[model samples]
Target: MQKGAEAVHAANPDVLVILSGLNFDKDLSFLRQRPINLTFSGKLVFEIHRYSFTDGKSWETGNPNQVCGQVVNDIMSRGGFLLDQGYPLFVSEFGADQRGTNVNDNRYFNCFLGLAAELDFDWALWTLVGSYYLREGVVGLNEVYGVMDWNWCDIRNSSFLKRISTVQSPFQGPGYNESRSHKLIFHPMTGLCVRRISFFQPLELGPCSESDAWDYTPTKTLTLTGTYFCLQADKSGQPAKLGIMCTNSNSKWQAISDSKMHLSSKLQDGTNLCLDVDSKNVVFTNTCKCLSKDKTCDPASQWFKIIDSTRKQNTTKSFFQSKQIAQFLGNTFSYIL
Candidate 1:
């Protein structure tokens, strides 16, 4: 493997030479003993694969927080140690059963996601195929772990994708660290995120990792990165977007709940419009009657968790710079072991 890696670099000095982990593809613990002596600059990367099934002793029945702590320790010791060694460690394979009903898988996945986010590890999710052409003489066998539907038309489990989105992008990677300063206004109902695609586009929810960084100011307004636009609301029933200079009170927001789930923005003349997802999945201001009148009222779409980014962020990458790097790394980051 070393010879092959060296040969690849020798043929193309600018290309990154990736080394797969040894010993059931889970053992990078050997790196603690020695180094992968790839003399090329920015050309050495290590990869490891993990599944919840490998060592799921107490994942299903134990306290989730306790299990998450234990599992994260194991992952750091085994493969995540590479990050400290000044090399990127890619989690090449990690996925769960898509049925959303498996107790073991469901628990293990939440634990896995916690570790991924805390470490800011670059990883890939397993699967895209739902039904197979043929497998062991059986046709149309269902693969519940697949991301696609049986007919390969729609996403099989959107919530699963949303949960994984928080880790796909590097909040803290090699170059930038100030990203911890931003907050992810995560919507719990649709399991999506609030992002501004363009200055003219309304603030909408999409995959969280792919979303842009947002600065929730002390003045109570949201500032979108890579632009001068800030979130603005024109009226009570209208959609919000990146516009206006963010000087008005309508742009300001406050936490109305003790748990900090409710983000209430002020309307003109002193009425408060709570931030909620509309029927179109767009974020806007609405009534906050449930907060005081009905405790059990389903106001989840208006619910958002402002997750403080706890890790460092990769330095700001311009489109051309990112494109150049992507060219060297190829079109995809996910790969099977």
Candidate 2:
């Protein structure tokens, strides 16, 4: 390990140095006494691997919430020492089987997310694709640990990405303040991210208009009208535009306008609510009483079911040699004006 570290420093002293913990025993106390070259550069980072299965079988059968707590404790017990010494810790690889048979993976991830949000560590998921080559043949083949397919083409599970993205990238802002009132819509099974902003203001003539009611019966379509306003932005923030989106499908809520109008409605829950613009504020009235009461304005109220039909095909057989692995990362943004 010291020889490797020395060679890395000899080649590029300025480059960030990372040391990996070998085997299952990761205690690093012995490194403190070694005469290894200590240029004392600030770029040295330590890497570690973690998995839900490492905690024990109890995590697999226990209640999700209880299992999550145990997982947190186990992780802390293993790496708490390094964290106390101010070393930068990276969870280089972590994932669960994609077959949906491991309940512990889900609980472990939820706990990992909560802890990650509260800590300063940086991490990358185990993989973005299924399949891997091994000496004894593919180990965890066609597993769901990957975010995309082995071909590196379409996303394997979009809802999974959506859930992680919410905790990873909570808001979008160039001129807008993220601290202000904002909303996010996430699909846990497919990693799609959407953000919405609502501002307090007086009403005016525009696309969003007050309506008696609306309906979303099969071929039925509805329109909403209201005044749109552009929020004044600070020099550091992105200029804000108002818009609206409508649909029962949480994954594909269509936007009516992009930063163009404020008063607008879309068919949701088989009905529509039209915004009546007034000098004081916009008012919402149901076009159809049945749909109105059911069309919740809260984004969190939306739910999604995992759809296996959306999984992409895996074309790469690299899981055999362990030399080749598929990787992909992406970001998407949608705004409802």
Candidate 3:
């Protein structure tokens, strides 16, 4: 592999040389013992592939939080650690069944998205093609993982596309000059973030780019950055509101599930409720469900991940105004944006 990388750089020094790890491009932990040596400095990249099947039905049987934590740790130990070592790491292939019925794939995606948002690494979806002309003696095989429909006329899953769109832009890193740190309550199932319209209005889920910056304080209160109001709840099924009385137990949130995705708070009556969204996109608090061992229940609606970001709030509007500017920013940030 080293010789091949050297030859590629020798032939074309201008192009980046991406190295793949052994064991189907999923293990690069070996590099920790022996670093790569090349004449070039800035153009070397490492790549890895991951999927729901990579760990063989673990997502189906195990708690998502535990499964995700274990998998992410393994990935970091493998090739993801290279990022900490100052080298670019690319998720060359990662995708899920877009049909939305595969339980394993569905569970894996929530876990995968959290890591993606945290690391903000460069990645390539497994494919764009909806169908194959032939594969292994089969004719016209349909690719369930493809982003497009088999006819190639429309998106196979628009919601899935929307969910991934949040990570399409960089939250930090090169060309992202923002220095302020804040949290965005991201809903992987909806591809939106928690947002507020006014002081007394109920909170709603909206475009992540318009998400309100939040602070997860030491007291476990979710406060709007630079504001006195904090997220509060009263009943188990009422809308989660912003209020100045933040010291109450109803306003103190905790990550309660194994996946640590469910943000729960104790109601005044001692009932534990989780952050949730309704069909109309209203954010609310409801009875915490499926904390563990229950695979039949779908907890996607209650899953909220509070991810850190350093994105400049003031400049994001301009970045969305022009496609040219968005593309320029993406390129200028190098491989990770």
Model 1 global lDDT (CA atoms, 0 to 1): 0.68
lDDT score of residue 58 within candidate 2: 48
lDDT of each: 0.68, 0.41, 0.84
Write down the TM-score of every candidate: 0.56, 0.46, 0.86
Lowest lDDT sum, 10 consecutive residues, model 1, at: 328-337
Runs in model 1 deviating more than 4 A are 174-337
lDDT of 3 by residue, 132-187 (tens): 89987888899999998999999999988888888988877778757587888888
Regarding lDDT, does 1 or 3 come out ahead? 3
User: Candidate 2, 260: how far from true, in Å?
Assistant: 44
Sliding window of 10 residues with minimal summed lDDT for model 3:
313-322
Clashes of each: 3, 45, 2
Provide C-alpha RMSD values for all models, in order: 13.3, 18.8, 9.5
Better candidate number, 1 or 2, judged by TM-score: 1
| 1-337: candidate 1 lDDT, tens digit per residue | 7789889988988877778887667878887888666656676888888887777656565544445456667777888888887887888888889988776676567556545654567787788898899987999988899999899988999878767766566655456465556666666555567875544456788866556777777777777645445666666777765554478777777776432456777767887777778788787767764453232344456666665563442235578655644552342233311
